[model samples]
Target: MRLLVINPNTSRGVTNRIREAADAMALPGDRFTTLCPAYGPELIVTEQDAALARQAVVDTVRGFKGPCDGIVLASFGNTGADPVRALRPSIPVVGIASAAFATARALGGPFGIVTFGKGLVPGLQAKVDEAGLSDALLGISCVAGEEFGDPGEVQTRFRSELEALCADMHQRGARSIVMGGGPLAGMARSLAPTCPIPIIDGTQAAISLIRAVAAPRGDHEPRRAAAPAET
Candidate 1:
């Protein structure tokens, strides 16, 4: 399957991070095409940044004429997902955060989020509320320091800190922890061994869910002429 992954932010580094992470999870026949907006904030940390990213995402989707079976919004907050779905109703569109939350819910317990910026906490909470999974969310934790210089380097820069946060969340009763932000896409796989609870990565979750959602089911095929209609 071909999946279109869009990063609302304009930072090429972050876009590259998303691409590498998605590529790492690609199956033999699966393909992921990742891109960033032509113009927008380098990184999204607040509602204001998201506001701009929403437009950037819409414009990028509008301009891309590639073939895809599904769309994955790489931003943790799932920026511009609604509009993209409206733009391409025939294809499946999955947001990273929505995918993460769904995975956490399916895991059967509350989940926590670990992100790079404290400023992102409110927006992430808003996303949780929007998903109607506020009850399932335990809490959100941020790395102990200012935002990083390069988003692509976050996984390496804060590996230990992120693992500690994951451990803390597990101790606090969280059954799983979501590694928030596009920059931290593939970090969970590396940290999972040490983390007491499950670590959900939004990027990986989005891809996995999209593949499932887009996969063809025999039951969904149109019935033959003699088949009876549903009551």
Candidate 2:
């Protein structure tokens, strides 16, 4: 299945990191293409950034062609998920926050989100409420997702940061931690075992959710299929 993960931020550095991580986690047979917005903020953290990214995503949805089996916003704020869904109305549009809400509810308790910064907590919490999982939400965490770099850098930072995060979750009485955002996109296997409860990455959840949502209809005429028959 061909899935496109749209990073509405202009930062290729961040966009590349998110793409590589998504590629690594995707199931076999799942093809992912990641691209950043031509015009938008470097990274989307606040409401203003989200608005900028939203405009770009709106344009993308309008111009999208090819076989897009599923689409992911590749953002914690989920700037374009709903809009694209409303616009496209065919392909399943999955967002990190929505997927996290699903994973959170499934984990069987209030889920806490570990985002880029505490400031994002309001927006993250709002997403939880919007997903109708507010009743099952615990709260947010410490290590800001935007601070995390590549895998090696994340390992250096997360080796300690993750441990502390887990400890904090334990203190908060959270039964699960949803590592939210593309920036905090790190290996889930290593953290899952040690965490007090379940450790879920919104990136992985969003990817898998997009995969499970079912591929788009092949009826949308592909260039090859649309070619006139040669008599």
Candidate 3:
């Protein structure tokens, strides 16, 4: 299988990190390709960035060409997802947040998302609500104390802040935690130890669901072949 993962954010550093983590989940027969938007905010830290991510998703699908069997939007907020669907209705475009949330629900629990930016928390709530899994979610929460666009310090600061947020959520009622972004994929497992509950990273959830949706499955195959009539 060949999966195309799109990081709607403009940060190549984050894209590179996502590419590495997502690829590791691929089975031996599968291949994964990752990309970042050439034109968009470096971080989807605001509603404006979400709007731009919608445009970026459209542009990406219009320009993509490869043996792509599945499409994964690399942002946790499901940025650009609905617009992309409007542009390319038939394509199987999966939002990372939606996918992760679905997986967490399937795993069965009160799930919580720990994301960056104060501005993005409401939007994340909207995303989860839109997915119709708000009932399954304990809540969508944010980790404060940093601006996502500060690329020079974003990575390290994001890690530390995410750690604290996950801990707090665990203290609250989050039975399952989604680390909540492509860039933070590598830290999901590490946080799980400190967390009293399981951690569901976007990469793991995305990859697992993508595989499930792609793989052929059924209780039984069709036993009858189509009949050809002689004219």
TM-scores, all models, native as reference: 0.89, 0.80, 0.80
Candidate 3 off by > 4 Å? 83-91, 146-155, 215-231
Model 2 lDDT, residue 117, Cα? 55
Encode model 2's per-residue lDDT on 155-197: one tens digit a residue: 4456677667776876888878887666665545567667757
Which candidate has the highest TM-score of all? 1
The better-scoring model by lDDT among 2 and 3 is 3
Pairs in steric clash, model 2: 110-136, 116-144, 116-145
Q: What is the lDDT of residue 213 in candidate 3?
A: 68
Model 3 TM-score on a 0 to 1 scale:
0.80
The 10-residue segment of model 2 with minimum total lDDT is 222-231
lDDT of 1 at 107: 95
How far residue 132's Cα lies from its native spot in candidate 3, in Å, is: 2.5
Off by over 4 Å in 1: 215-231
Residue 189 accuracy (lDDT) in model 3: 68
Q: Per-candidate RMSD vs. true structure?
A: 8.1, 6.2, 9.0
- Residue 124 CA error for candidate 2 (Å)? 1.2
- Candidate 1: residue 77 lDDT (0-100): 75
